[model samples]
Target: MTTETTETTGTEAADIQAIKEIVATVQRTQRAKDPEGFLALFHPDALWTTGHGKVLIGLDAIAEFTRAVLPAANWEGEVTYEPVHIQFLRPDVAAVKVRQVYRSAEEESEGAPLYVMTKRGDGKWLLHACQNTQVQAG
Candidate 1:
Protein backbone atom coordinates (compact mmCIF):
# COMPACT_ATOMS: atom_id res chain seq x y z
CA MET A 1 0.00 0.00 0.00
CA THR A 2 1.08 3.57 -0.62
CA THR A 3 2.26 5.77 2.22
CA GLU A 4 -0.71 8.10 1.73
CA THR A 5 -3.18 5.19 1.89
CA THR A 6 -1.57 3.98 5.11
CA GLU A 7 -1.84 7.40 6.65
CA THR A 8 -5.48 7.77 5.70
CA THR A 9 -6.27 4.32 7.02
CA GLY A 10 -4.58 5.13 10.32
CA THR A 11 -6.50 8.36 10.59
CA GLU A 12 -9.83 6.68 9.96
CA ALA A 13 -9.12 4.05 12.58
CA ALA A 14 -8.17 6.75 15.07
CA ASP A 15 -11.30 8.71 14.36
CA ILE A 16 -13.46 5.62 14.84
CA GLN A 17 -11.79 4.84 18.13
CA ALA A 18 -12.19 8.39 19.32
CA ILE A 19 -15.87 8.33 18.50
CA LYS A 20 -16.20 5.04 20.31
CA GLU A 21 -14.61 6.57 23.36
CA ILE A 22 -17.08 9.40 23.25
CA VAL A 23 -19.96 6.96 23.14
CA ALA A 24 -18.51 4.97 26.01
CA THR A 25 -18.11 8.18 27.95
CA VAL A 26 -21.80 8.73 27.48
CA GLN A 27 -22.50 5.48 29.29
CA ARG A 28 -20.05 6.31 32.02
CA THR A 29 -21.67 9.65 32.69
CA GLN A 30 -25.10 8.08 32.76
CA ARG A 31 -24.06 5.31 35.09
CA ALA A 32 -22.38 7.82 37.36
CA LYS A 33 -25.25 10.26 37.00
CA ASP A 34 -22.87 13.04 36.08
CA PRO A 35 -25.13 15.43 34.31
CA GLU A 36 -22.57 18.20 34.04
CA GLY A 37 -19.99 15.99 32.43
CA PHE A 38 -22.53 14.57 30.02
CA LEU A 39 -23.79 17.99 29.06
CA ALA A 40 -20.27 19.07 28.26
CA LEU A 41 -20.34 16.82 25.19
CA PHE A 42 -23.20 18.67 23.58
CA HIS A 43 -23.10 21.60 21.17
CA PRO A 44 -24.68 24.85 22.25
CA ASP A 45 -27.53 24.53 19.78
CA ALA A 46 -27.96 20.78 20.19
CA LEU A 47 -31.37 19.19 20.14
CA TRP A 48 -32.44 15.98 21.81
CA THR A 49 -35.58 13.96 21.55
CA THR A 50 -36.01 11.56 24.43
CA GLY A 51 -37.09 7.93 24.25
CA HIS A 52 -40.43 8.94 25.66
CA GLY A 53 -40.99 11.55 22.97
CA LYS A 54 -40.01 14.69 24.82
CA VAL A 55 -38.37 17.21 22.54
CA LEU A 56 -35.62 19.23 24.14
CA ILE A 57 -34.14 22.11 22.18
CA GLY A 58 -30.78 23.65 22.93
CA LEU A 59 -28.17 22.88 25.54
CA ASP A 60 -29.94 24.70 28.35
CA ALA A 61 -33.06 22.58 28.03
CA ILE A 62 -31.03 19.41 27.78
CA ALA A 63 -29.07 20.44 30.84
CA GLU A 64 -32.22 21.08 32.77
CA PHE A 65 -33.72 17.75 31.88
CA THR A 66 -30.54 15.81 32.39
CA ARG A 67 -29.72 17.41 35.73
CA ALA A 68 -33.17 16.62 36.98
CA VAL A 69 -33.30 13.02 35.77
CA LEU A 70 -29.79 11.61 35.85
CA PRO A 71 -29.16 12.18 39.50
CA ALA A 72 -32.54 10.92 40.54
CA ALA A 73 -32.54 7.81 38.38
CA ASN A 74 -33.15 4.72 40.49
CA TRP A 75 -31.62 1.82 38.68
CA GLU A 76 -29.89 -1.20 40.19
CA GLY A 77 -27.21 -2.01 37.63
CA GLU A 78 -25.03 0.37 35.68
CA VAL A 79 -26.10 1.62 32.30
CA THR A 80 -24.10 0.70 29.22
CA TYR A 81 -23.83 2.63 25.97
CA GLU A 82 -22.22 1.01 22.95
CA PRO A 83 -21.47 2.53 19.59
CA VAL A 84 -23.13 0.18 17.11
CA HIS A 85 -22.50 2.20 13.97
CA ILE A 86 -20.97 5.43 12.69
CA GLN A 87 -21.43 7.25 9.41
CA PHE A 88 -19.60 10.36 8.35
CA LEU A 89 -21.76 12.83 6.49
CA ARG A 90 -18.82 15.16 6.14
CA PRO A 91 -15.30 15.34 7.44
CA ASP A 92 -16.62 17.28 10.39
CA VAL A 93 -20.03 15.72 10.77
CA ALA A 94 -21.07 12.19 11.71
CA ALA A 95 -24.06 10.14 12.66
CA VAL A 96 -23.55 7.52 15.33
CA LYS A 97 -25.94 4.78 16.33
CA VAL A 98 -25.64 3.67 19.93
CA ARG A 99 -27.13 0.92 22.02
CA GLN A 100 -27.87 1.79 25.61
CA VAL A 101 -28.57 -0.97 28.05
CA TYR A 102 -29.84 -0.36 31.54
CA ARG A 103 -29.25 -3.40 33.63
CA SER A 104 -30.28 -4.35 37.11
CA ALA A 105 -30.45 -7.53 39.12
CA GLU A 106 -34.06 -8.12 38.28
CA GLU A 107 -34.71 -5.89 35.31
CA GLU A 108 -33.07 -4.83 32.10
CA SER A 109 -34.10 -2.30 29.50
CA GLU A 110 -32.54 -0.80 26.42
CA GLY A 111 -32.48 2.29 24.29
CA ALA A 112 -31.29 2.98 20.78
CA PRO A 113 -30.03 6.49 20.27
CA LEU A 114 -28.83 8.17 17.12
CA TYR A 115 -26.27 10.84 17.79
CA VAL A 116 -25.37 13.42 15.20
CA MET A 117 -22.00 14.86 16.09
CA THR A 118 -20.09 17.79 14.70
CA LYS A 119 -16.40 18.37 14.94
CA ARG A 120 -15.62 21.96 15.75
CA GLY A 121 -12.75 23.99 14.33
CA ASP A 122 -10.93 23.30 17.56
CA GLY A 123 -11.09 19.57 16.77
CA LYS A 124 -13.56 18.63 19.45
CA TRP A 125 -16.57 16.48 18.67
CA LEU A 126 -19.80 17.77 20.13
CA LEU A 127 -23.23 16.29 19.84
CA HIS A 128 -25.33 18.35 17.43
CA ALA A 129 -28.65 16.53 17.45
CA CYS A 130 -29.88 13.19 18.74
CA GLN A 131 -32.86 10.95 19.06
CA ASN A 132 -33.22 8.47 21.90
CA THR A 133 -35.60 5.64 21.14
CA GLN A 134 -36.82 2.97 23.50
CA VAL A 135 -35.98 -0.59 22.58
CA GLN A 136 -38.91 -2.77 23.45
CA ALA A 137 -38.37 -6.18 24.87
CA GLY A 138 -39.66 -9.22 23.10
Candidate 2:
Protein backbone atom coordinates (compact mmCIF):
# COMPACT_ATOMS: atom_id res chain seq x y z
CA MET A 1 0.00 0.00 0.00
CA THR A 2 2.77 2.39 0.94
CA THR A 3 4.70 1.74 -2.25
CA GLU A 4 1.60 2.07 -4.38
CA THR A 5 0.72 5.32 -2.67
CA THR A 6 4.18 6.68 -3.27
CA GLU A 7 4.00 5.76 -6.93
CA THR A 8 0.63 7.43 -7.33
CA THR A 9 1.88 10.56 -5.63
CA GLY A 10 4.92 10.68 -7.86
CA THR A 11 2.84 10.26 -10.98
CA GLU A 12 0.50 13.03 -9.91
CA ALA A 13 3.42 15.37 -9.26
CA ALA A 14 4.93 14.61 -12.64
CA ASP A 15 1.60 15.14 -14.40
CA ILE A 16 1.15 18.54 -12.75
CA GLN A 17 4.68 19.52 -13.68
CA ALA A 18 4.10 18.49 -17.28
CA ILE A 19 0.90 20.55 -17.38
CA LYS A 20 2.73 23.61 -16.07
CA GLU A 21 5.47 23.18 -18.65
CA ILE A 22 2.85 23.06 -21.38
CA VAL A 23 1.34 26.30 -20.11
CA ALA A 24 4.74 27.96 -20.04
CA THR A 25 5.55 26.69 -23.50
CA VAL A 26 2.29 28.02 -24.92
CA GLN A 27 2.99 31.39 -23.36
CA ARG A 28 6.57 31.52 -24.60
CA THR A 29 5.70 30.32 -28.08
CA GLN A 30 2.92 32.88 -28.51
CA ARG A 31 5.12 35.77 -27.40
CA ALA A 32 8.14 34.76 -29.47
CA LYS A 33 6.61 33.25 -32.62
CA ASP A 34 8.41 30.00 -31.96
CA PRO A 35 6.50 27.62 -34.21
CA GLU A 36 8.82 24.65 -34.16
CA GLY A 37 9.55 25.21 -30.51
CA PHE A 38 5.86 25.37 -29.73
CA LEU A 39 4.90 22.41 -31.89
CA ALA A 40 7.50 20.31 -30.17
CA LEU A 41 5.27 20.31 -27.15
CA PHE A 42 2.22 18.97 -28.97
CA HIS A 43 1.14 15.50 -29.93
CA PRO A 44 0.96 14.43 -33.55
CA ASP A 45 -2.83 14.53 -33.63
CA ALA A 46 -3.28 17.62 -31.52
CA LEU A 47 -5.70 20.41 -32.31
CA TRP A 48 -5.41 24.17 -31.84
CA THR A 49 -8.14 26.78 -31.91
CA THR A 50 -7.45 30.48 -31.58
CA GLY A 51 -9.52 33.19 -30.02
CA HIS A 52 -10.45 34.47 -33.45
CA GLY A 53 -12.28 31.17 -34.00
CA LYS A 54 -9.68 29.73 -36.32
CA VAL A 55 -9.13 26.04 -35.96
CA LEU A 56 -5.96 24.20 -36.91
CA ILE A 57 -5.92 20.47 -36.64
CA GLY A 58 -2.76 18.34 -36.82
CA LEU A 59 0.86 19.49 -36.85
CA ASP A 60 0.92 20.68 -40.44
CA ALA A 61 -2.04 23.00 -39.99
CA ILE A 62 -0.66 24.20 -36.68
CA ALA A 63 2.65 25.11 -38.27
CA GLU A 64 0.94 26.97 -41.05
CA PHE A 65 -1.26 28.86 -38.67
CA THR A 66 1.65 29.81 -36.47
CA ARG A 67 3.68 31.06 -39.40
CA ALA A 68 0.84 33.23 -40.58
CA VAL A 69 -0.16 34.71 -37.27
CA LEU A 70 2.90 35.04 -35.06
CA PRO A 71 5.38 36.56 -37.48
CA ALA A 72 2.92 38.84 -39.21
CA ALA A 73 1.99 40.71 -36.10
CA ASN A 74 4.32 43.40 -34.83
CA TRP A 75 3.79 42.62 -31.19
CA GLU A 76 5.95 44.69 -28.89
CA GLY A 77 5.05 44.12 -25.29
CA GLU A 78 5.03 41.68 -22.41
CA VAL A 79 2.43 39.02 -21.65
CA THR A 80 1.43 38.33 -18.08
CA TYR A 81 -1.22 36.14 -16.44
CA GLU A 82 -3.16 35.68 -13.25
CA PRO A 83 -3.95 32.12 -12.29
CA VAL A 84 -7.69 31.38 -12.06
CA HIS A 85 -7.86 27.59 -11.92
CA ILE A 86 -6.28 24.39 -13.10
CA GLN A 87 -8.72 21.50 -13.19
CA PHE A 88 -7.31 18.04 -13.71
CA LEU A 89 -9.63 16.05 -15.92
CA ARG A 90 -7.27 13.13 -15.84
CA PRO A 91 -3.71 12.44 -14.89
CA ASP A 92 -2.76 13.36 -18.41
CA VAL A 93 -5.29 16.10 -19.14
CA ALA A 94 -6.38 19.37 -17.56
CA ALA A 95 -8.30 22.58 -18.11
CA VAL A 96 -6.68 25.87 -17.17
CA LYS A 97 -8.33 29.25 -16.81
CA VAL A 98 -6.40 32.45 -16.38
CA ARG A 99 -6.62 36.21 -16.76
CA GLN A 100 -3.92 37.25 -19.17
CA VAL A 101 -2.52 40.77 -19.34
CA TYR A 102 -0.68 41.70 -22.51
CA ARG A 103 1.10 44.94 -23.07
CA SER A 104 -0.80 46.83 -25.70
CA ALA A 105 1.26 47.48 -28.79
CA GLU A 106 -1.44 49.77 -30.16
CA GLU A 107 -1.13 52.12 -27.20
CA GLU A 108 2.18 50.68 -26.02
CA SER A 109 0.60 50.06 -22.64
CA GLU A 110 -1.04 47.27 -20.66
CA GLY A 111 -4.36 45.49 -21.06
CA ALA A 112 -6.16 42.61 -19.40
CA PRO A 113 -7.23 39.53 -21.33
CA LEU A 114 -8.88 36.36 -20.17
CA TYR A 115 -7.77 33.02 -21.58
CA VAL A 116 -8.80 29.39 -21.34
CA MET A 117 -6.43 26.52 -22.08
CA THR A 118 -7.09 22.81 -22.32
CA LYS A 119 -4.34 20.23 -21.93
CA ARG A 120 -4.09 16.79 -23.54
CA GLY A 121 -1.72 13.80 -23.82
CA ASP A 122 -0.18 11.30 -21.46
CA GLY A 123 3.54 11.98 -21.20
CA LYS A 124 3.46 15.71 -21.82
CA TRP A 125 0.63 18.17 -21.62
CA LEU A 126 -0.26 19.50 -25.04
CA LEU A 127 -2.52 22.51 -25.48
CA HIS A 128 -5.74 21.17 -26.96
CA ALA A 129 -7.50 24.53 -27.10
CA CYS A 130 -7.22 28.17 -26.09
CA GLN A 131 -9.56 31.12 -26.18
CA ASN A 132 -8.62 34.71 -25.49
CA THR A 133 -10.92 37.66 -24.90
CA GLN A 134 -9.83 41.28 -24.72
CA VAL A 135 -10.67 43.31 -21.66
CA GLN A 136 -11.92 46.82 -22.17
CA ALA A 137 -10.24 49.61 -20.26
CA GLY A 138 -12.45 51.13 -17.61
* Best by the lDDT measure: 1
The global C-alpha lDDT for each of the candidates, from Candidate 1 onward, is: 0.84, 0.60
Report the C-alpha displacement of residue 131, candidate 1, in angstroms.
0.5
lDDT by residue (114-135, candidate 1, tens digit) is: 9999888887788899999999
Residue pairs with backbone atoms closer than 3 Å in model 2 (clashes): none
Residue 58, model 1: lDDT of: 98
Model 2 compared with the native: what TM-score? 0.69
Worst 10-residue lDDT window for candidate 2 reads 1-10
Off by over 4 Å in 2: 1-10, 81-83, 105-122, 135-138
Total clashing pairs for each candidate: 0, 0
